[model samples]
Target: MLFVDFTPPAPCVGDLNNDGVINTADLAQFLGQFGQTVAPGTGADLTGDGVVNTADLALFLGRFGQSC
Candidate 1:
């Protein structure tokens, strides 16, 4: 049998939503998932506070589209 990893990759520190880079797209993505629980291994936890809550979303939005 073959095994495949199902864990979501880490989000780029600047890539708030983990879509790829820090931009409006990321901001939109974060907003879409706002108030939702990010699964384990998902990099939605921008603040690294433990869970992907509104705080993290806020942080992401705050830096939305800002350069690294």
Candidate 2:
């Protein structure tokens, strides 16, 4: 038997709520911050442009349902 320790990356993208999963909750949070300049650490702005817009939403949607 072999047991190798593996650590996942920190702060997975698309995980707005930091719940380790990208789902409706993240989508809801994104929608809530849509068209607004959210803070840098909010994670709602997928594009990292300080603002949550269609482009960011599109990017987020592409990664929907993915697990961190």
Best by TM-score: 2
- Against the unseen true structure, what C-alpha lDDT does each candidate score? 0.65, 0.83
User: Across residues 1-68, which tens digit of lDDT does each residue of candidate 1 receive?
Assistant: 99999988754564754456688776676667666666643556676555777778677777666664
Q: Judged by lDDT, which candidate is best?
A: 2
Flag regions of model 2 displaced more than 4 Å.
1-10
Clashes of each: 0, 0
Candidate 2 overall Cα lDDT vs. reference? Answer: 0.83
Cα RMSD, model 1: 7.7
The 10 consecutive residues of candidate 2 with the worst lDDT sum are 38-47
